[model samples]
Target chain A: MNYLLDAFAWIADPAHQAGPNGIWARLGEHLGYSVVGVLLACLVAVPAGLWVGHTGRGRGLAVGLASAARALPTLGLVTLLGLLLGIGLVGPMIAFVALALPSILAGTYAGVEAADRVAVDGARAAGMTEWQVLTRVELPLGMPLLIGGIRSAFLQVVATATLAAYVGAGGLGRFLFLGLRTQDYPQMLAASLLVVGLALVADIAFGLLQRFATPAGLRTTR
Target chain B: MRWIGDNLDVIGGHLVSHLLLAVPPIVASFLLALPVGWLAGRVRWLRAPLLSAAGLLYAIPSLPLFVVLPLVIGTGVRDATNIIVALTLYGLALMVPATADALRSVDPRVVDAADALGYGGVRRFLTVELPVAGPTLLAGLRVVAVSTISLVTVGAVLGVPSLGMLFTDGFQRNIMPSILAGIVLTIALALVVDALLVALGRLVLPWTRPAAAAVVAPTQAEVAP
Candidate 1:
C-alpha cells in the first residue's frame, strides 16, 4: 500500500537516522532498558525458580504468584509506579522486570520439574550430592526449556519496554506516541514495523539458541 | 475502600464496558479458531506456519497494537472498536494453537471406534474428538479468558472506557487508593473468572477430573525422587 511505502521512505530517510531523535538512538535506549530489565528479572527469578524446582517445595506458591503477576496490567503498573516514583526510568524498568519475571520463573520451574525423574535418581544414586546433581544433571537437561523461558522473557521485555516512552524514558515508543499526537500515520506505522521486526528477529535468534543449547541426547525427532 | 465507594457508579460503568469489550472477542476467537485449528491439526504441513504466525502475533506488545490499530483497521484512535479488534487478534493468537494442540491430542483409537460405529467425519469430530479433547480445550480457554480480562485494562492507555480508566484517573490525580482499587479489582476479576472457568470445565467434562486426580497421585511420589 502507499502508506507502507511512505512509512518505508520515512525509515530510509537520512534525516531521521542522524539526530539524537534518530531511530538507531531510540533503539539503543530501548535495548538498554530491555536488557537491563530482563537481566534483573533473570537474576531474581531464575534462581528462585531453580530452587523451588530443585527442592520440590512451593511449586503451588510459585505457580500462583506467577499467574497473579501475569494478570497485572502492565500499563497500569507502569503509570502507577510512575505516579509514585516521579516518572523516571525506574518506574518503567520496574514494570519491564515485572513483566518478564513470570515467564522466566514459570519456564524454569516447569523445565526443571519436567526433567526425567529416572535420570535425576540415577545422578543421586551415583553418590552425587544434591547440589552437584542439580548443577550437573538437572541444569543441562533442563537447559532447553530454561532457554525457552528466557527467550519468551527477552521478547516480552523488548516488546513492553516501549512503555518507557510513557514515563519520559526514550525508546521506540516515542515514535508511535509522537506520531499519534501529530497525526502522523506513516511514522506510527514505521515504528510499529520496527517493534514487530525486532520481536521477530529476537524470536528467531532465540529459537536457534534453544536448538543449540538443547543437549543432543534430549533432541527429539519431530 | 472509601474512594471506591464514592466512585462506585463510575467503576461499575467501566466494569460493564470492560466485560462487553472482552467477552465477545473471546467467544468470537474461539469460534474462528475452531476450524483453523482443525485444519492445522489435520494437515501436517500447515502446522508450522500456522503456529508460527500465532506466536508472532503473540509477541506483538499490547501498547503498539493499541496505538497502530486505527491505521490498520480504519477505526478512530479512541474507538472501543479498536480495542475489540486488537483483543480479538490476541485471543485468536492464543486460542488457535491451543485448539490445534487439543484436537491433535484426541485419542486416535476413539476416533477409529467412532468410525466403526458408523459415525460420519463431522459427527465423529463433534461427538468424539471434541469431547475427548475437552479438558485441554477448556484449560486453554481458561488461560485466554484470564489474559483477555487483564489485557482489556491496557485499553485504558488509549482512553477506551474500562477498569483501566480508573488507573489513568488515579494516576493523573496521584491517588494511590484509586490505583490500588483498580489493581485489586482487576486481579480479583481475573481470579474469579479463572475459578468459574475451572468449575465450568469440571461440570462439562466430568470424566476428565477423575483421570486428572489419578495422574496427580503418581506425580506426587515422583516429586520426592
Candidate 2:
C-alpha cells in the first residue's frame, strides 16, 4: 500500500515532471517513436497488403510474415539492430517497422477479405480498372479492418518502444531501467503504470476511431 | 564463427534454461485459458469483458512486469517463478482470445447434436467441442509457443539466466557475437518449436487433414466424395 502511494507520488511530483528527463518529455519520446514506427510500417505494408488482397496472390506469404514477426523477441531485435546500425532511434525504429508491418498487412488484406464478395465481383464486371476496383470497391469496405491493423500495429510498437531505452534512446523505459538499477520500486511502478495507462488510452482511442470510421451501413451488416 | 564456437557451452546452457522457462508458461497458460475461453465462447455477454480484461495483461511491458510482479505475487525479483508467472499472464492474453475464436468458429449444430446424443456438459465439451476446436487452438498454440520462447529472454535483465543474458552482455560489453548468438538462437528456437507444434497438430488432429476438417471428425458421414 505504501509502495502504491509512493508510485503515485512520484508521478505527481512536479519536480519530476519538468526538464529533459521529466515524465512528459519521456512520454513524448516514446509516443514519437511509436507513432513514427507505425506510420513507416503503413507505407510499406499497406500497398503490399492492398495488392495481395485485391489480386488474391501471396496470401500465404502475408500470413506467414505476420506470424513470424509476432514470434520475434523485441528486446533481442532492438539490441541486435543497435549493434548493427549503431545505437539510436533509427535502429529501434527499423525494428518497430519490421514488427508492425506483418500485423498491419494481415489486417489490411483480411479487411478486403471481409468485404462483400458480390460487390467486388460487380466492380470487376462493371469494367473498373484494377486500381479503381481497389480504391472504389475495396478501400471503403475494408477501411475498418485496415484501421484495426493500424491499431494493433500502434499497440505493439508502443509497447516495444520501451526497449528503445535499452538502446540509449529516450522513453519511459529509462525510468524502468533507472528504477531497477537504483532499487527505486516507486519509480519502476510509476513507469509501469504510465506505460499501461498510455496503452489503455491508445486502445480506447483507437477503438473509438475504428467505430466511427466504419461505414454506418456495414456496421449493422456485421 | 570462432566467437560462437568459443561460447557454445554458455549458449547451450542458456538455450536449455530458455526452453525450461518457456515451455511451462505455454502449457500452463493454455490449460488455464481453456475454461475461461470456453465460457466466453458459450456465453455471449461475457466475451467482450473477458477478452478485454485478458488483453489488458498484454499492455503491461514485460520489463516492468518482471520488475513489479514480485510485489503482487510474493517472490524474489530474480526468481524463475516470477518470470513464469509474468509470461503466463502474457500467454493468457493471446490464448484466451484465440481459444474463444477457435470454439466460436466450430459449427453450432455439432454442439447441439452432441447434446441431443445424451452427452453431458463436460463430456460434450471434451468429446465434441474440443476436437473441432483443435486446429484453431493448435494454431493459437503455435503462436503462443513461439512468442513465449522469445519472451523468456526478457528475464535476463533481472539476472535470470537465459539467452537474453547474451543480449545484455553483448550490449554492455560491445561483444557483437554474443548479441548475434542470442538473436539467432531465440529466432531458431521460436521456429523449431513452431514446426513441432505444426507436426503435433497433424499427428493428433487427423480430422483436420481433409479440406473439410472443420466439419469432419465424428460427423464424417456428412462428408461426401
Per-residue lDDT of model 2, residues B127-193, tens digit only: 8888899999998888789888988988887789989999999888888889888988899999888
Which stretches of model 1 miss by more than 4 angstroms? A220-222, B209-225
Give the local distance difference test score of model 1: 0.84
| Superposition error at B57 for model 2 (Å) | 2.8
* Cα shift from native, residue A171, model 1 (Å): 0.9
Predictions' DockQ, in order: 0.48, 0.59
Per-residue CA lDDT of candidate 1, range A10-121, in tens?
9999998777999999988887887888899999988998998899898999898877876787767877888888867888888888888988898888888878999999
Q: Tell me which residue pairs clash in candidate 1.
A: none
Q: Candidate 2's error at B153, in angstroms?
A: 1.6
Tens digits of per-residue lDDT for model 2, A1-222: 678799999999999999999999999988988899999999999999998998889999998888778667788888888888887778888888998898899989998887799998899899998888889889889999999999889988877887778778788989987887898888988987888788878988987898898988888976
